[model samples]
Target: MSEAFVKGCEGLPWWRGAVIYQVYPRSFRDSNGDGIGDLAGITEKMEHIASLGCDGLWVSPFFTSPMADFGYDVADYRGVDPIFGDLGDFDAMVARAHDLGLKVIIDQVYSHTSIEHAWFEESRQSRDNAKADWYVWADPKPDGSPPNNWQSVFGGPSWTWDARRGQYYLHNFLKEQPDLNVHHPEVQEALLQVARFWLDRGVDGFRLDALNFAMHDRALTDNPPVAEPKQRTRSFDFQHHYHNQSQPELIGFIERIAEVMNGYGARFTLAEVGGEQAAREMKEFTHGQDRLNSAYGFDYLYADKLTPQLVREAIASWPGEEGEGWPSWAFSNHDAPRFASRWWGEEERPRAVKTALALLMCLKGNAILYQGEELGLPQAEVAYEDLQDPEAIANWPLTLGRDGARTPMTWTDSACAGFGSTDSWLPIAGPHRAMHVAAQEADAESILHWTRKVIALRNAHEALRCGEVEVIDEGGDLLAFERRHAGHRIACYFNLTAAPLALPEVSGSVLLATGDVAPDQRELAAFSALIVETQ
Candidate 1:
């Protein structure tokens, strides 16, 4: 649990104050030239992840599925999808990651399953089957409409009629993905067993996906309309999601999951929480010792801009007080637009990207780095004809498709960006092809190398890793904060605007700085960041 670094320190949990790399399986790398990344591909790139100084890697789902929602809809919890390779492949990948001293965390979607899952199949067969109550099945209203006013996240009604059962089944996502009856004791036990299965298979942890949707109000009450209806293209955004999700009962199920994970020893569990009540729900989900270790919200992932106020508010939400859960920060991920694309202009991207990465490492929580973020890869321009996200396809020009952010990783300057011999499933951006790993590896001043340096600096300093944070300034265009642990103190300052800002008078030794920012400088240049160790 501990690694020797600075003097006077204790061993910390592997996940505490660690940086985790996120890999979207279908886009990270392709093995066998299948145009889709697989387990073997990720295994081959394990060295690259380890080289980044991240403590671990979180791999998105690769379970048995028909790809209805691209692997988020699981068909079998125990089986591996043929396209991504088999159990043997997964085991080999885990072994390789362990050999590199990296933890492996896999996504677990407990809230729902594919319609093709055995349990869902049996549940839909008849009302008297062994697994009849395995899924959420409700009868229609008087006029044969859906039982309630709940809406699916992918758009339209949350219910789909099954002719054989003569009832409507709840699906928070696509109709092909049916919500599970997690409130049932048997269902809870079944999910716990699934957790144990993976733990036994040597997975270091699990990232619970859409955990707030795990349970619904048993009464099936209609969700009331929002107080002020904002312009929204999707029906799901019109109502307050009171009855459909975020039930208090979800804590009970989370405890059950905790019990299973605790038995395995030192296993990490994090939840992917979203929606309006995300802050409260995230705290609740990881509130106590018998709950999840950490949970991340969409604070930065979906933000329109990265400002000092946003960072301050987000960090304040989880203040590391008594009983408060640890927070994990992610600037970019599979579901959100790349941070570089979301927050900066094309001309200022280089400095802005480096500043953001340094700030993320300096924050007082675990940091999550998306697959291509170290290379400063922007959102790919996926044409409407090539779009593959169901939500983006359904919503069209209204919503920027996630396909733009999930493009295949750029491995080389070759055609197809060396992702595979064949064309990638998602087109590699023309600009991204030029920012390939091979080119960056050859350039000493590339963002990839800067990323490694910042991560290493964080690892070397206890004050930055697991310290108490004190916000000094969070005013417009400038953010200043201090990280304190033991007798070591470090200060971080960021210039979040395009104009120069005079540095506050301070005395310290320069530790790390981005964009020509130095301790001797009196003012920070546009989009610059400075980190220093105060004596």
Candidate 2:
């Protein structure tokens, strides 16, 4: 490694060019034999996470919740749910993770709270209550209709009639998750208190869930109809989503959150932004030094196909520079189908898995790896009866419920796929068992091993970390780009097609390869990928 490369990384911000491995707490690993993975389970698996050479772990919500939205509907921002463990377990986990040199970033769902949350419950009781304005409660129209035409992402109208308050409260998701009225000064203070609570507990950072939805137009203007055709199956796609989310006022609130984080020292905040204007909103959220550190959208996570054109477009969407915010990329997460099954047919799953990992790691900006991704686990096939996600159930066969992605991580090939002593909360059958962590760990050339090496290789070079990405050429099934930082540059390539292709002439040293390259300049095998450092 060049000294300039080492110097570039040493001075880089903790998250600027870091790799964060995402852990969906419910599916990572179960340690209490309770069928569900908990904080304790994650704490026990710190070694595996640290071994990946990732800079940090972005754990999904484990806060006290009603489980209506799984952990997303938080009941207590300051406490852990009994199902996941208590405050003591959380503190211990943080301590252990820090010891392993891993920054711990927990989820902060500030946009809404479970109906069971005290703040929401109190706010819903009466219009005259002290917390009446804590939530987005508005009087109904003269005909007892909703105040606006906004719709929820989950499926129905955004406003729900509250008998006790004689008004309708806004809910961007399930009714159980009522949107918080961040416009209220007290509400902002309360949310800041929630952040301070975690900061005091020594958390390294936070992954702000649905950040764009945190603030809405106080005038409650109706969202305009989408002028363009919708290609996605999401309910929110039907409208323009103008007033309901991605409000301009959200930037000020994000700055306030960043101010609070800055007081805590090197704390990072990443927003999960998505909607019609995701790219613009993401850049806005992270535009200044005083706002969110970074933001990730649905660009890759929700993509149904992995093509060179799509990859180029997604990366080019966000131009990282002096003033613009950084972008974080993820191919799969708890909310989307596994990329392996989404991108490749069942027959070519293995090659697709290896190629996907290499492609993700080589991409500029922070990379997030979901649980079980390293093990090359394909999406679990959950029957309709077993489906737990409300969106999936509502959309049925058209959308595979998120439960397919939430299946317990197969640790061993034993009963329950070593997820637990009893049957896991979600079944662990099919291709998951053969691709368990234990099974793959024993194979030196497995995807899991390659992921580790890819991460290590990326870490060793500054060009692949926080460099500017320039698309050299994206034609046919081959995708090529160069990541440059200062004078150092590295070219990364991926062959998304099934048949082999001739290697294009390039001036670079082979740093890593997901497959063997033939001397005869034959076509690249199905789904092959490589990273080369330019001379």
Candidate 3:
């Protein structure tokens, strides 16, 4: 790698209190009039991303794949898919992003690869092959059934039969995304090679997908059933997922990845972890300086209501101190429904959106802003026939498909909403066109302006960036907390309910507010939020 590729930040930590704008490349922009987003398309929009006042951009997976799980199931790690452009386009995109002062972080799916991956194909060929131990393969039971009772996240047995090997291999998600055997030394080396390849290409960091699932029980034990019934449809929910994921050895592997990143200076790494024991495991994975820089769980992503109590509990769990891992919070993402539609109905959508944005920006840890969230876009209602996510389709009626959150970006009111010349890969209709980027840019009070202003405020305030949070009070629907650093303190308050709220007993000046605030008294309207700096 060139010196520039391994360049370290001068006296700065790449991740501390960073605002990362997440780009779902497929829905971000389109070039060549292909309707689907490509690397070149991202390069064209680098300026808009930089204008958002974020320190970096985290682009989701866009590697060569069969689109089985969109871009999560990688067939080629080093090369970009033809649909998303090739390696050259990715390099150009990286250069352009850097020129705009935006650090580029790409997704890395090391836990599994598409069955079409050459390693998986060769491993399944024969037991004596050079890559036979590349994937997590095992023999079946005497009854010709799966080795254990583990279940796939897509609603079936976790083990799938292979006609050639006459055995079953474990898969935590879809059958096509077979789990890799990270336990093997050779497998670890191969995965590291994939990371090094990207590092050589000048990518700043990686968002490791399913980091907990990278290791599993070597014995292939059956996971015990859950005591309570699950309300969701994923087959994996029936059990506690003991043998399938969150193995202790996963930390050692993360340490190895961290060592590689350390060699490259200021490169950052974050894990996407979620499960029954996710919070505990997340802390463990990032407890030390040698592990991942940060980890994010589903606490905020799956939350139905953003209450004061919920916010307090989530923040309090991770106290800012030495030896404690940092957190990356996200209210909405590509995998789940948008927070605007999920948290508030159409009546309170605009206020709730602004409040949510302010809360996320003021939080002490790193923040991830999902695509289209700045415009207060609601989840699109997709018909059954148009559904694409396998997890959603399998659990239809019970859980909405992720396609609703993966709709194309509404850039203009023109046909296709200025996303492309042709129809979008996913439908874009209803209130989406009216909430287009052009329309929002014309409206001064739009959510986009509120988001930019809050982000700027957070960036400008040192206390809001890396301060320690202390819950001041959680009375009624009012949430109040203090962010303090180097004797500087700022109080953040939120009226989560649909009613006016009086400020807590704190002598401070209102620094920022999502809505109008009375000057004489610290009063805010319903669903409002404010940040006040101490005198």
Candidate 4:
């Protein structure tokens, strides 16, 4: 039994302070040599996930799709796309994960469905069909233009014209993804059935994608503009997004979702909520009884720098209270640039890697560690011709998009980098290959080892897992905090800068230390993180 398990969470669940590794299925592993990763491929590589010591794995969407928005635009909720494999393959993968002691959380896209989905196809046929009102259909304004001034996240207006219905249908993302009429009771029942299908298939939980966008304001209203410090790269960034998403009706759907999952025992539910109103939305979506178990924000995902203030604000947002919900933290994921490249310059990345890993482990909430983070993989350079992500293609020279960070995982130093024998879907260049898992597994000083140590430390201490967090200092280069669980006090400190920091007077037995830390003389080198026990 883990020392961290010495005392069970007073009233909390296993996922309260767990670590979940995200697997972007398309680039994880390719078993068929089809240049695309599949469910069978993931099954073949389950050992790597288990070795990470993460409590579970969160796999991205693999539902039948038209490749629009990749798998995010689901064509069918119950079927696995042929490219990823069949339902049998999914069942086998889930069984394999359970055998390896890892919980499986699949992605569920509730906000919208691909234009090719049977529901959408039927919804667009005619206004009088059984499924005609299944999607958000609206009549154009007086000038026969879009219903409102809302913009799609990819580009252009959020409403698409349909000749059959002779009305515009809402699409908050790509035009290929038509927004579902979530307010329809029939739609809610259909979604509940989808959850039941997955739970019966043996999934332990779900990672709801763009959950806030699941419902939209019924009245066709225009969205207001916003003032921002950063230049607006896309049209979606120009507006406040009030009428288009984060509707209050979404909470009721979450309650229904909880009901469906709760019927299946201890199933996990995590919401990927993002927007200008994320702070309030997260609490509303997760707080109190019968809501989502947890929700994550885009705070650290888009952060240009890893400042103490940033960490403090994120932690302070989710204080464990009577009715407050739990928070989930993620530094990197499939949708944004890798944290290493964003936070540290190329020359100083190695030191920053160790410190960042340490910092994430010491946090209070559940940590979502994206695939390949353990190897300290920085964002790979994806040339324009090599980019696969639709977002990058849509916003070309204006933004790097997410293709750079979504490059295929590097597993070896060979030509195919041990991913497969043929050319992969996305490029796996020399830089990524240099930090391959094989090389890191052999090097004691590798970022891989450091990651394992940090995860191990978290598993060995309840104080670091589900403890009550209190910020001691968050100024300059130092970010210090104390975590207390069952009267056991632990102090965690980190230097998130390139210069030395004077160590404060600390009375504790050192549990873990990385970088330059001289306790006797009271000094810590650049990018140092030290953990200790007291009382």
Candidate 3, residues 1-535, lDDT tens digits: the string is 1122113212247577888999998988888787798889889878877877888899999999998999999999987899888899999999998887888999999899999999999999999899998899889889999998999877889889999988899899899999999999899988999999999899899999998899999999889988786554666778988888999988888999999999998888989998888988989989889999889767788888888888888887898668988899999899989999899999999998999899999887899999899899998898888887877787886774488999898888898898888877888857899999889889999988888899888877767877788988845778888888768889888888888877656566878887666435656688888788983
| lDDT scores of the candidates, listed in order | 0.91, 0.85, 0.86, 0.88
Candidate 4 CA-lDDT value: 0.88
Candidate 2 clash pair list: 500-523, 500-524, 501-523, 501-524
Report clashes for each candidate as comma-separated counts: 0, 4, 0, 0
Q: How much is 479 displaced in model 1, in angstroms?
A: 0.4
Off by over 4 Å in 2: 1-6, 227-235, 518-523
Worst 10 residues of 1 by lDDT: 1-10
Model 2 TM-score on a 0 to 1 scale: 0.96
Q: After superposition, how far is residue 202 of candidate 1 from its true place, in Å?
A: 0.6
lDDT of 4 by residue, 225-244 (tens): 87772657788888889999
TM-score for candidate 4: 0.98
Clashing pairs in 1: none
Give the C-alpha miss distance for residue 114 in model 2, angstroms.
0.6
Candidate no. 1 TM-score: 0.98
Clashing pairs in 3: none
Candidate 1 residue 358 C-alpha distance from true site, Å: 0.5
lDDT score, candidate 1: 0.91
Please give each candidate's TM-score.
Answer: 0.98, 0.96, 0.96, 0.98
- In the predicted model 4, the residue pairs found to clash are none
